[model samples]
Target: SEGKTSFGMSIFNLSNAIMGSGILGLAYAMANTGIVLFLILLILIAVMSAYSIHLLLKSADVVGTRAYEMLGLRAYGQAGKIIAACVVTIHNIGAMSTYLYIVKIELPFVILGLLGKEKDFGGWYVDGNYLITIVSVCVILPLALMRRLGYLGYTSGVSLLCMVFFLISVIFKKFVMECPLKSIDPYSNNGNKTLDPRVMSSHINSDFMATPFTTLMRSHNDSDFIPRFIPVMISSHTAHDCREAKMFTLTPEAIYSIPIVAFAFVCHPEVLPIYTELRKPTKKRMQNVANISILAMFIMYLLTAVFGYLTFYGNVEDELLKSYSASDTLILCVRLAVLVAVTLTVPVVLFPPSSSGFCDKWHR
Candidate 1:
């Protein structure tokens, strides 16, 4: 009891595990899948994830051991144990790498923004590799050294707050940011026909208001996976059109979005450890913790995907934040907040393998 974690902290830890850099890609995934299809996929994944946890907890109970590897051992001897350990190690290592990669990509811009320099300004400080090294040593390493998984709960709470800020910023930006982004070039200037901005804006306003209910569903053949440009009365105003909304899509891009959505919910490996540390730990209680955590992340993920997709429409980039202007103060702050969230998350991701004895040598 002395070293156990409360339900609230356990939720925080598990919530942090559920959320990561994967969230930034949800909008892009939505762009490919469309609003309706994406929501359906998301709800299905969340339900499946919870059900998977239920099976895991049930298995651990029957095996009379809390360790995932031990459950494997009971089921299939040493081979199962090793396979389990390897799978956990590989998955978590990949998760850690993804988190660090976010740090590498975004840290430079964050530092540059703080220093009032151009996003492209040159310096060793702005070098992603160098910044990642510094962050690894100064931030992640120390946190990863903690012996108990429960200790990281405080940092996890902080990390969740950062993501909440990111979510709020995305929702706020949806209202403030307009479509057919002025920063993006609609047409190449290489002796090509160009439309006047004033005329285009007027067309957007008039056509969008007059034909508010007009819907067009572009037909796509099974082999036609390429994104096609559909001509509309107004050039870029089509983004706001109901016709652009695809209830379902069979494109290769939509298929590719499946993995992104699936992987975004991978917190199963971390479940047992948190369950073991849970105060007055019981199968039913831990299940409640897992369910609540998944639900919270589900809300955040859905809101983030919907609002972010609405903001950028089909033009949304894989990394949603990258699609925004770096010079915007609000976006800059969101960037830093994201950096903090992911940086703190690396240590939590490291815990599964490290506790499994995968990092025994380093600890010794």
Candidate 2:
């Protein structure tokens, strides 16, 4: 009771748990599902997540236990408890892995960008495996080792701020980036037109033109390579062709998009712990926390997905930040913010599984 967290801190922790590396991929999901359908799915998932939290809290009150596994045990038997614990453990582990993987992939690039050597990837400093290991040992390990979830409230607040900065940067970039109208030269072989190699490379390697030729061209120096391949390369196009954002449609990839949208609201596993640590723990108060956190995240996720998808339209990458030019100073700063946000989130995601393990041992 002495270390109980106030309502604001509890909200911070829950909000951090809800927002993670999943935000980076929402734009791609929106691209696949279209604007109207994506908004519908997002709203549905947020409401479902809040309702599930309410049910979980009600069940906990009835059983007189805050432990999720114990709730399962009361409802069923040993098998139910085991199943509940295993499911929570597996889901949190996957979430933690995803956060760390973002660190691994993006940290090196952030370091290189800060050093003004974005192309320099030859050192151990730029190695993703090494960066992730150092970060885990230096940053995440200490935060994860804290005995109380409340202690993470401060860090969670900072993480949420970083995401807000990221969201704002995304909206700003949408206005500044211009789509190249004549991104491809169709009559190059007929000696009537020519293409800028830089423009061509940007369109092929960075935009939505994902083809075998684009993949092959990325391996070579663009200036030297594009001239030789200009005669045969006719399939290449630009983001101008993809400027129309879909309003009401779904691609075959919606199968994957649905899961992405659903899982983006997964703060259920962290709800009870936050509730347990609340300054004035009550079902009504905790439900309010859940509602506020989900609502906050829903707005952030929607703004991020909408602006990000609008910027790239059909050309948006799985990672929204990757769709931008790496040399853009603002985007580089955004990359850093995103990297920090995900890195700090690792500790929050790590808590559920670790606490579950400690609970099991204490019970024994």
Candidate 3:
């Protein structure tokens, strides 16, 4: 696999596939859910991502070809081919959908912050060349157009870096750090007025149950009284549905910051390319690449979660930039840059799917 694939390739593929617009949506997931659910979500995603890698490796071993190339063909023949095609197409579509959503969320700010302009938003009509669609196009077409994964060698590096910058910009704020309301929006005074002692005391003294998160949890579970459930059944309920819902939300939150803590656990097909592409001089390097990628992502995600919590505590937005999307310069540059980057990124994702399709026909 060294000369044929290499560890480096795996890293790039992993980064590209896993590191999409998922980052922006995570903060809200964490905040809406709570820390416990967040941790649970993280573990689930990691396990899934790990299993994904294992399955791919196992598939390669069994099929004597890459996971995408023959997993479908071996399992079900031509029908398998169609299913594989759908899987790849769906992945591409999902990637595009995610890109569109994130860009739609991030673009307004980039435009405003950088170019001082705004584009149509999620208010309606997303399919008509929305940001998400455009973003996906940008990420996919250019890279898809490359004709070979080898060409993406450097662009992957930049994407990795961009992911880093994204993490730093969002997180790094656990060291820094809110709530409010009144007829009177106690927080609505525009930040220039002093807090009312009575209100402050009332708020602080209020029951923890009143907290937005607490209220939401109670409301969602419809359980005002917790910790009283049967121990055996706890695993049956909280461990499954509650846990899945919780972590899935935070998995994204924890993705970039605690990169390692979480990256190992994604469930997407993109991880294969990363593992396949590794430099693989030794087991140590292989582990190191995985280790560093996860570590970097962990730190990045942790910070993002923190920043999101601090920046918009009571009402955390999945797309943190939305508030300023209308005038965010950095957001604009990023959108435009990603528009370019995605061009290179999509092909990198599509190749495996295409080859899978060809093999299915050839085998027939």
lDDT of 3 by residue, 1-364 (tens): 5434555665665556555555665565566655556556665665565555555666665676655636677888878867876777677666555544545664455544453335544443333346556655655555565544556767767776766665554543323321211112233353323334234444443322122221111335664433222111001121122213233343344444354335333434554444455554343454455555555555555556556654554345555544222334454454556544444455555656654545446335
1-364 per-residue lDDT for model 1 (tens digits): 4338889999999999999888999998998988889999999999999999999999998888878789889999999989999999999999899889888988888888888897666789999989999999999999999988899999999999999999999999988865533232323342122434334444344333222222323346644233233322222344345325555655568877899899878899899889888899889999999999999999999999988888877667788998887789999999999999999999888888888855668777
The TM-scores of all predictions, comma-separated, are 0.84, 0.83, 0.61
Error of 3 at 143 (Å): 2.5
lDDT of 3 at 126: 33
Better of 2 and 3 by lDDT: 2
By lDDT, who's the top model here?
1
lDDT-based ranking, best first?
Answer: 1, 2, 3
TM-score of 3: 0.61
The TM-score obtained by model 2 is: 0.83
Clash pairs for candidate 1: none
User: How far is 56's C-alpha from truth in model 3 (Å)?
Assistant: 2.5
TM-score-superior candidate, 2 or 3: 2
List the lowest-lDDT window of 10 residues for candidate 2.
Answer: 227-236
